[model samples]
Structure formats: C-alpha cells, structure tokens
Target: MSYNMYLSALLMAATCCSLAISYLCWKRRELPIAISYGLGMLTGAFYTFGYAFEIVSTSLEHIRFWLRIEYMGIPFGTVLWFIMVLQYTGRQALVRKWLVATLMIVPTITFVSHHTNEWHHLFYKSMTLNYSEGFPLVTLVKGPLYKLHVYYSYSFFVVGMVLMIQMFIKEKLRMKKQVALMIIGSWGPYGFTLVYLSGVIYMPIDISPFGFIISGVFYMWGIYQFNMLRLAPLALQKVFASMQDAVIVFDLDNSLTSFNQSANRVIAGINNKWIGQPAVQVFSQYPVLLEKIKQGPFMEGKVQLAGHADEQFYNVHVSFINDKNQRPVGKMLLLSDVTDMVRSEITLLENARQLRELNTFKDKMFSVVAHDIRDPLAVLVNLMELMEEEMQTYGEDQQEIVNEMGQQIHNTFTLVESLLEWFRSQSGGMIFKPVERDLAQTIQINIRLLLVRIENKQIHIISEIPKDTFVYADKEMLDLIVRNLLSNAIKFTNFGGTIRLRADRSDHKVVVSVSDTGDGITSDQASMLLQEDYPVSSTGTAGEKGVGLGLTLCREFVHLNGGEIWFDSTPAQGSTFYFSIPTLSEASSKQSDSLRGGRA
Candidate 1:
C-alpha cells in the first residue's frame, strides 16, 4: 500500500469512530450538553473524512474541492468544542444565542471565502502539488484571512481548555475524575494544532485530524464509562448563594451536607468547615436549634437570639428531602429573620393589655359608686313623692321648688344608669346570652319605660313592627339599645312631634329603625355620636342634660350582637337611627333547642 493510502485508511478509521460516538450520543439528545458534544464530534469527523479524500485525490481540482468541504467543519468544530465545555461546566448561560451566532459568522465567512478563493486568494495565497515521501501532498501558503481564522480557532481552543481546567479544580471529589478525563480529551487536538501552528514539525502533513481521533476516543469513554451525560452539573449554586434566608441541608444520618451564604449570618459561628460534620455537633453552640433538629424531620418554630440591648427573632421551617421513590434522604432547614415583626407584635399586645387593665379598673369604680348611690336615689325619689302629696301645706313658691328638685334627681339617676351600662360593655364585664325574642315585645317594653318622657314631650309613639318578628340577640343588650334610642328620640323631639318604631325583616336579618320628626342633628354631630372616644354631650331640644354615653353604648351592643348601626340625619329634618340583627331562623332555633336539651 502507498503511504497516502495508509494515511487515508487511518483518517477513515478515525472518521468511523467519531461518527459511531456521535450516533450513540445523539440517542440521548434531550440533554443539551450532550447534543453539543455530539455535534462537535460529528464536525470533527467531517473534517477528517474530507481530508482523507483530499490526500488521495489524483487531480488538483479534486483536492481543492475536498479542501473546501473540509473548511466547512474545521472552524465550526472548534466553536462547538468551546460550547460543549461551557455547557458541561454548568456555565451554559454564558453561551447566549447571539454569541453562538457571532461565533458561527466567522466560520460561515471562511467557508464562502475558501470556495471562491481562486478569485481573491483571501483564504489561500497559493496551492501547489509536491511529491514527498512517495505520495502526492497538497501544500498551501496561508492568506491574511487564513491567519485570522487560525487565531480565532486557537482562541476558542485555549478558552475551552482553561474553562475545563477550572471546573476540574473546583468540582467535588465525585466529579473530579470525570472532569479530568474531559480536560485530557479536549487537550489532544488543541496540543497538536499548537504544534502545527508553531512549526514544530517539518512534515508536509497536518496531524491535527489524527489528534481529533484521540479526542473522540476519550470523549466516548467519558460518556459510556462515567455516565457524564446523564449526571447534571451543580447548577443551583447561584440560586442557593443569592437566597436571603439561611438554608442548611443535612443528610439522612444528620450530617450537614451543604449550606447557603446567609446561613453563617443567621447562625453565629457557622462556616464552611461545618460541611460533612454531624449537625448536632456543628450546631452545639446553638442549643435551641440543635434540640429542635433532634425532635424530628419536620419542625416549625421561632427562636430568640440574645442581642446587645434586645433580642433577635427568627422563624424556622424544616422539611425532609425525599428520593425518587419517596424515601427520606435528607432534610433542609430554612431560617427567616422575623425580629421586626416579633417586636412590633409584642409592643402592641403589651399596650392592649395595659389599656384593658385601666378600662377594667374604671368599670369597677363606676359599678361600686353606682351600686352605692342607686338605693339612696330611690329613697330620695320616694321621699319626694311623699312631699308632693303634702305640697298643699306649703305656699306656691315652695311647691314649685319641690317639683324642680325631683326632676333634677330623675335626670341624674338616668345619666348614672346609662354610664354604668356603657362601662360594663366597654370592660367586657357583660355576658352575652342570645335567644329567640319577640322584636315588637322588646320595643313595647322600652316604650313603656319611656312613657313618662313621651307624655312630657306630648310625642306620639307609632309602632310598625310586626308582632311575630323575632331576632337572635342578648335580651339585656336589646333592652338597653331600645331604651336608649327611644329616650334620645323623645328628648330631641318637640311637643306634639312623632316618634316611629319600624322593623323590616329579610331572609337572614331584621332591620329596626327609630325615626323621630324632631329638631335633628348636623352631619358632624351624627358622626360623633357613634364614636366611642368622642365626647358628645349636647342638650336635648327641651334643654335636657346628657352625658353622651347612650349612643356609644348602643353602637357597641349592636356590633356585639353581629349587627351594624348607622344614622341618617339632616339639619332641622329629624334623624332616623337604623340597626340590623340576625333573624331567628327555624333551623338554627331548632338546633339551639336540641343542644340545650342535650346539655340539660
């Protein structure tokens, strides 16, 4: 066999090996990195196969044709090699679409230039046939554009090698061997190309294609032996490092495997040295955290860390990691700093507790005072009645003075009663006991209690409420609300005015309204009447004294009964205060009765 024949055979064998490897890799083309490696191998095969044909071609024309075909793969193969390395190292984000296109542009231009080289001589300055080593070899002097292509190819090769080397150094022990093989595979063609470019060999033949055969063999070994294509590189490091919450991962045996950047900040004394150590030993300084881990795989709680003047709070969440078969393999703990939220909640709760205590004390004082004065006031009222009976024994001036004193005492007693009721409601001293009660009956009772005031004002009381209407509310609360509203209406209305009590029932609730045709309130007064903190003590149309506690108590009772109260009023047009309470549904009433019977 001729020397050229031997070279052709060698190149053919290399091409077949590369094509076979490319086919095997293409079978698992779902993996992007694997596809890139396969493409590089295929391109290398093309270059070698075309060069083999070019070497044995009898005519210069045939050799030139084969050389142009070879140009198609030469530049593209180098770029693909760089891309494969980048993808394998989990740095594929750097190989953007535009960057890949940019890399291809030069190779595309080179291929076109080579095809039309005879016209411009931009790819090859001159081509000649030389008889050396008893075989025909095509020799060419490179053009300026060809040198540029060389530099471009060499840059990619060098960069790819550098990236692979860096990855090998940084990769874990399990991955080091695979990365090392990849580096060796990549270096073969690059080393030979460097040797050719440096003029280290005087041979007319370029041996870079032979070097690619060695590269293909190594790559195949990595694919089949190490399962390199199947294993995904550690790509979550970027995401893990950027997390704001501290994250720690531990193996099933309770040994710390990994942690994020924020872990050290959250757990003082934490460092990289903690990796691969037992979590209990590593977190020994943080007894709370260590004890929590010992509890179980799932834990959620808060921890307080001692600080200079206060304390830092953190909310921790722990969960177990499961394998594909749903077996527990590890656990991950996430700690989120909640110092601000904790402090705010604590301060708010303390203030609320203090306010509640003060309100309770105030209620107790009022209750005690009212309890003491109520009996004496009743005695005084009885004594006044007896004095009125003996009024004929006195002069007209003495009789008038007696009547005035009785009226003052009555008003003072009413004010004190309203104040006591309001204090009990505010301090949560009143117990709520809701039962089925007739709405009309409740209204009638309140109207009877306020009959004296209604007669004094000469106000006509009209009731439009149905006799069968029922509601679900505490009886005492309902009584107080009705009494206060009726009393206010009678006080505000002039003599001969009308006070209307109406109720409208829907499927779910009953709306009761007390509307009076009296000297009404302004918008501001109406708004202030419902506010608990606003002090509103305006005199009635008849110059009656008020402490402004009636309406405040009414609003509180209405809300506590799962109801709402609002008023519509216009200056000099009278006011209508409306409140809604849930109606007694037959199903709910029956259920309550059944429960009561069962309890009894």
Candidate 2:
C-alpha cells in the first residue's frame, strides 16, 4: 500500500476504536459522567475519521473540505472531556450553563475562523501538500486563531488532569485504582499533544488521534474492570467527616465498614484500624451497645458511658441501611450527645418538686392559724354582743362603741373562714364534683349566705340570671366563687349602691358576672389579684379588712372545673368580675364525662 493509504489505515483503526468505546459508554449514558464521556468519544471518532480522509485526499480542495469537518469535533471534544472529569469527581456543580458557554466561545470562534480561512486567513496563513514517509499530508502555517485554540484546548486538558489527580490522592483507599486509570487516560493524549505542538518529535503526521485511542482503551478498562462509572467519587466522605454526630456503618455481615471522624472522638480506641472487623467484637467493651445491635437491626435510646468521671449522655440511634432496591444491605449507628437536654429536664423537675413543697407548707400554716383563731374570735363576738345590749341601757355613745367592737370581731371571723377555705382548696383537701346545677339558684344561695353583710352595707342586690339557667360545674366551687365575688362587691360598694348578678349564654359556655357600683380597684391591683406570687389586699369602702386570698381561690376553682375568670375594673368607678362555666349541653356533658373518666 501507498504511504497515504498506510496513514489512512492507522487513523481508521483509531476512529474504529473510539467509536466502539463511545458506543459502550452511550449504553450507560443515563449517568452525567457517562453522557459527557460518550459525547467526547463520539467527537474524537468524527475528528479521527475526517483526518483519515484528509490524509488520502489527492487535491487541496478535498483536503480542505475534510479539515473543516475535522474542525467540528476538535474544538468541542476537549471541553466535554473537562466536564466529564468534573462529574466523575463530584464537582459537577462547576459545570454551569454560562460557564460552559464561556469555555466554548474560543473553540466556536476557532471552528468558524477555520471554515472561512480562505477569506480572512485567520485560522491558517498558508497550506501545502507534502509527500513524506510515503504519505500525502497537509502541512500548514497556523494563524493566530489556531494558536489561541491550541492554548485554550491545552488549558482545559490540564485542568481536567489536575482534578483527576486530586481525586486519586484524596480517595487513596476507596476508588483509588479507578481514579488512577482515569488520570492516566486523560494525561496520555494531553502529553502526546504537547510533544507534537512543541516539535520535539518530528513526524509527517500528527499522532494525537492515536494517543486518544489509547486513552479510550484505558477508559474502557476503568468502566468494565473497576466499575468506575457506578462508584464515582461521592461527597459522603467529606460530609460525614465534618458531621458533629458520631456515625458508624456496618455491612451485611455486621462488620464495621466505615466510621467518621466524630465516631473516633465519641468512641474511645476506635479508628480506621477497626474497619472490616466484626462490630460486636470491636464494641465488646460496651456490651450494652453491642448486645442491642445484635438483638435487632434497629435500636434507639439514651445511653450513659461508664468510663467518664461526669455522666455522658448520648442519644443512640441504630437503623438498617437499605440499597436502591429497598433491600437491607447494612446498618448504621448514630450517637448524638444530649447531655445538656437531659440535665435541663432534671433541673426543671427538681424545681417543680421544691415549689410544690413550699406551697404545701404555706397552706398548712394558713390552715392551722385559721383553725386556732376561729373559736376565740367567736367567743369575743358573743361577749361584745351581750355587752352591747346591756350598754343600750346606759347611753347611745357607749352602745355605739360596743357595736363597733362587735363589727370588728365579725370581720375577723369572716376573714378566718375565708382563709380556711383557701387552705383546703390549695392542699387538695376539697373534692371537685361537677354536676348540672341551676346558676340562678347557686347565686341565690350565696346571696342568702351574705345577707347579713348586704344588709349592713345597705347595698341593693339585683339578679338578672334566668331561673332555669343551668351550667356544668362543681357546685361547691361555684358557690365559693359566687360568695367571694358577692362579699367583695358588698364590702367595696357604698351604702345604697347596687350589685347585679347576671348570666349570659354562648354556644359553648355560660358567663356569670357580678357587677358592683363601688370604689373599684386600681389596674395594678386587678392584675395582681389572681397571681399567687403577688397577693393584693386593701380595706374596703366600709373599712372591711381583706387578705386578697378570695379572688385567688376563685381563679383556682374556676380552672379546676374547666372554666376561666377575668374582671373589667376602673379605678373609683366600679368592677365587674366574670367567670365562664360550660353550659349544660350534650357536647358539654360528654366532655365532662371524658374529663371525669380521665381523672378516675
């Protein structure tokens, strides 16, 4: 065969090899790296085939036509190769649309300039047919655009090689051999091109296409022998290494496959040396953790390590690691430190216990004082009343003094009774028994109980509540709430002032209110009345003494019966205290049953 035929035959072989490898990669083109690599190989095949035809062409016109065809692939193949390397190395984020377009601009310019070289002489300044080594080859004086294309192409290849080398170095234990193959494949063609461009090796024909054939062979080996495409470098190692939680992965045989940097810090004596060892044997020192892992593939709880001087709390979570097919291929253990959270909860519980104890002590002291003073005060009131009857026989002034003493004793006794009731409620000595009761009847009963005070104050009491108005509430709590509110109104109201008791109904509940025309409380006092921490007490309009416990007890009882109490008050104007109790309905009755059942 002639020399041109021989060169053509060699280029044809390289073209056939590139096409075969491209076809194999195309079959797995679903992967981004595979698609990029396949397209690159296909472009190489096109360029090689075109060069082969150019080698045997007899005329300049035919040679130039083949060169234009070759230019189509030469400019784009290098960019594709660079993108493929990025994808393989888990740096595909760099391959943005605008960035790819920017990289392609010079290559596009070169291709267009080469096609119109005859007009502008921007790709090739001169061309000649040379018969050397028994082949007809096209020799050219490259133009400025061709030199620019060369620099751009070499830059892309160098960047790709650098990225591949980085992966090979960083991923020494895992996927190292595969990365090595890719690096070798990428470097071979680039090295050959450098030699050809530098004029270091004198040859009639450019051998870069043959170097690409060698690269394709190495790439094929990486794909078939090492499974490089399927197990391309992933970012998992970097992610796990930086994680705060300790993570350990086990294989199907329960052998420790891998662990992160945090795992080493969390578990003493654990390191890369423990990899591939049976997890149970490796963690034998912590038998609880090992046994739990052996019992089932899943376990999670707070675990305390024994070696530390201070208690170390970890939230241990173990779960099966499944493959893409949802088949369990391994198990993962995650140890998250929760010492702070556990300690906070413990502190909160202790504080709550202490608070309850303090409240109990306070309630006991109040109960004892009220119990001890009641009898003595009762005797004093009786003695004063008897003295007042006798003094009426002496003079009006002496009788008035006796009457004032009797009023003071009565006020003290009333205060003692209220304190005793408050103590019983706080100490849980009082039982809560809710039933359907007439709201109006409950108010009337409280009214009768406070009749003496009402008569003394000369306050007119009006009831706007309907006779049949019923509510679901604890009867005793309701009575206590009404009595306190009425007594407060009577004590604060001026003589001849009016006090109104009314009930309003909504879909869910009935609101009972006590509105008084009296010297109302200040805004700050109203706000502090229901707060146990800040007790509010003041003398009433008629100099009636109070300790502020009545409103506090009213709030507690209302809440116990699933009700709420609030007041609208204006200083020196009047105050209206409102409490809501569930209205008697089918829904309310059922809810009451549920609450009772839960308590029982």
Candidate 3:
C-alpha cells in the first residue's frame, strides 16, 4: 500500500471511533448535553469517511464527488458542538428556538455554495488533480465563499473553547478533572483545523478529521470514568444548593460526605469541617436522628430540635442514593421544617379539650336548673287549676283575670319540659332502643295527653292511621315525636279547623303525617325550619310560644333511627309534616340478615 493508502486507512479507523462514540452517547439522549454531543460525533464520522474516500480518488470527477459528500457533515459539525458546550456548562436556557435558527443560517449558505460551486464558482475558483505528490490528490484554488465558510467554522470552535475554559475555572474540585479533559478534547479539533488552514503543516490530508479521534477518546473516558453526562452534576448542583430543605449526604461507611447550605444554617454544629466524620460524632446532640440513620437505608420521622428561643420541629426523610449500576453508594437525609404545622395542631387539640369541658358544664347547668324550676312550675300549675275551679264564685272580670294567669303558668311549664328534653338529646344522654310497637296506639296516646288543648282550640282532628300499623322505633322518642307534632298541629289550626293524622306503608317503611288546615308558612320560614341548627320560632294561633327545639330534636332522632323527615306547605292553604320509620317485619328481617352475614 502507498502512503496515501495508509492515511486513508487511518481516517477510516477514526471514522469508526467517531461512529461508536456517537451511538453510545445517543443512548443517553434524554440529556440535552449527551444528545447534542452524540449528533456532533455522528457528523464527524460522515466528514471523516468522506475525506478517506477523497484522498484515494484518482479522477477529478471522483474527487469532486467525495468533496460534496464531505459537505454533508461539515456544515453541521461545529454548530452542534457549540450547542453541546452550552448545555454541558449549564447555560442551556440561552438556547432558544430563534437563536438556534439564526446560528444555522451561515452553515446553510455554506452548504449550498459548495454544492453548486460548478455553476457560480463561489466555493472553489478551480478544481484539479495534483499528480506531482506521487499520489493523485484533489487541489482547490480557494474562492471568496470558501474563506467565509472557514471563518464561520472557526468562530464556533473559538466560542466553544471559551465556554469550556470558563467552566473548568469555576467547577468543583471533584469535577475539575472532567472539565479539564473536555477542554483538551474540544481544543484539539480547532488547533488541527487552524494548522491545516494556515498552511503551517505540509500535509496531503486536511488533518482535521484526526482531531475527532482525540475528542472521542477523552469524552468516552469522562462518560464511563467520571460519569460526566449520565450524572449531570453541573445542572443538578444548582438546584441542590438552592433547596429549602436541609440536606445531608453520607457515604457507605456512615461518614458525612457533604451538606447543603440549608443544613449548615438549620442544624447546629454542622459545617464543612464535619465532612468525613462519622454520623454519630456529627449528630451527637441529636441522638434520635443518629439512631434512625443507623437502622436502615430508608427512614422517615418527625424530630424536635431545641432552638435558642423556642423548639423547632422537622420532618426527616432518609433515602439511599444509587450509582449508574443501581448499587447503593450513599444515603441522603432531607429535613423539612414543620414547626408551624406542629404548633397549629397542638393549639387545636387544646382548644378542642376546652370546648368539650365547656359543653359538659353547660349540659350539667341545664339539667340542674330545669329540674329545680320544673317541679315548682308543675306544683304552681296544679294550684292554678284548683284556683280556676274556685274562680266561678267570683265576679266576671276577676274570673277572666284568673284564667289569663293560669294560661301563662301552663306555657312556662311546657317550655321547661321542652328545654329538659332538648338538652338531654343534644348531650347524647338519650340512647336509642328501638322495638316493634303499634304506631296507631302511640298516636292515640299522645292525642289523649293533649286532649285539653285540642278541646280549648275547638279544633276537629281526623285519624286516618289504621289499627295494627306497627313500626320499629325507640318507644320514648316515638312518643315525644308524636306528641310534639300533634301539639304543633293543634296550635297552628284555626278555631274549628280540621287536623288529620295519617299513616301508610312505603317500601318496607311506615310513613306518618300530621296535617293542619291553617295559614301555611312562607318559603323563607320553611327553609329555616328544615335546617338542623337552631331556627327562629313564631307564635301560634293561640299565642303559644316555642323555640324550634322540637324540630331539631325530631331531625336528630329520625337520622339515628335510619329514617327521614320532611314537610309540604302550600302558601295560605295548609301544611303537612311527614316522617318515616322502618316497618316491624322489615326491621326484623334486616337484623336477621346482619346476624347471618356476620357468621358467614
């Protein structure tokens, strides 16, 4: 083989290296730095391969064909390298879409000028084979556009070199070696290209393609040895240093490796000097944290630290850090300040305890007062009844005055009884013990108890509930519901007005209703009454007073018994209040099914 053939073989070998590195780097294309560098290497392979073919060509036509092939990689190589430098140095944010397009303009013009050089002669003034060198080689008389392409390519190499140099000067101690290798690798290509362009070396070949072999070797070493592109320490370091959480790194030996600025500020006795110290020694003041770190690779818990002024709380999280091979190399502990959250929870717990105590005291006070006043009010009502019987012997006006006094005493007695019942239900003193009972009999019993009031109002009542209409409910709660609803109906009905009590079965439930023919409530009043909270009560037709506790108690009891209550009121016409309870047979069947399910 001749000297030119040996050079061609060397170029082919370099092309193989560039292609291999391109494939390896492209595998990690998720990283912008890796992908851009990979593309640069791929174009380098194309340029080197075309140069190998160009150097061995015997004819001018074959030489020109190889030259055009070289242009395919030449236009893209430097632009891609410049972009890779920007990303590798953590300046990728400056690579906007418009900026990239603008950079491509000169390369695009260079490619077109070279390919159509036969028409305009702008890329080369003349092209011929120089046989004087023993082997035929393509020799070109440089054109004006050719110089423009040379200058443009040199500009990118210069900029990329400056960026890599700047990064080397500022990089961390451990990363300095990697950056140094990168600088040397990138500078090799520029130096070789300059030597060829300046005619400093008498070489048959361009000599620039060999520079890519240097780049591939150094870049491959940095990738596998220093984990340059895979780890991306330059980009991640910026984010790690700016975190709000205090982060501490530990090696496999449990020695402190590094810590962020936040760790230095928040943790006492933590400083750069503590690096390489055992975790136990560094965390001597925080025994709990040290113990947790020793337990395993992963841990999470809350720790309280005593500050100079007050106590501070932090949520500590520890996780293992794995290398590229997924082997555990170190662990990181992240401490996030949660003092405000902890203090708020503590304050809420204290307030809740105080609220519970206040509720218990209020319930006790209501019980004592209701009991003391209710007994006396009952005795007073009985005495007034005796007085009414004797009042017939007095004058007409004196009898009227006695009757009014008796009505006031009765109203007071009724209010006291309601207050006692309301307080008991609210305090959970009323336990629900449901049993099957005849619902019609329950209604009749409440009516008999309120017979006197019904007679006084001269209201006519119709019972539509059939006999043996049974339902499952707490007996006392059921009686209270029937009595309150019946009394409300009687109070609202006009003199000699009609009142109806009805009951019907609906889907395993018995629905009961008490209706009255009186002036119905407005929409606003209906909304207020339906709410579970304390609602405003109005005076009845007979001047009877209330506080709406009866409706609230009814809703609570209905929900506890697995039932529902509702009402329908037509303005200026009348109102009907309805409530539903489970039927006796249905309730028994459900209880039996529940027992069977539990056994199964």
Measured by TM-score, the strongest candidate is 3
State which candidate, 1 or 3, has the greater lDDT.
Answer: 3
Alpha-carbon lDDT, every model: 0.74, 0.74, 0.75
How far in Å is the alpha carbon of 85 misplaced in model 3?
A: 2.1
Tell me each candidate's TM-score: 0.45, 0.45, 0.50
Residue range 1-600, candidate 1, lDDT tens digits: 678788889899989988987887676554466577888888888889998998888878999888877777887888888888777665655777898998998888887888889999988999998887666778889998898888888888878888878877876664677788788888777787778778977757888888877877887777556645222222124576688888887655565656777888877776644544677777777777776676656645446644312355678777776544565556677888876676566556545654664466457546545654565467667767767666756534455656666666765676678766655654554445678899999999888988988888899999999898989987877888999899888888888999999999766789999999987888677666676443456778888866555776677678767689998887787999999998767436544443333221
Worst 10 residues of 2 by lDDT: 227-236
For model 1, the superposed segments whose C-alpha errors exceed 4 Å read: 229-600
Model 1 residue 12 lDDT? 93
> Could you give candidate 2's per-residue lDDT for residues 32-93 as a string of tens digits?
56678888888888788998898788888899999988888888999988887776665655
Q: Which candidate number has the best lDDT? A: 3
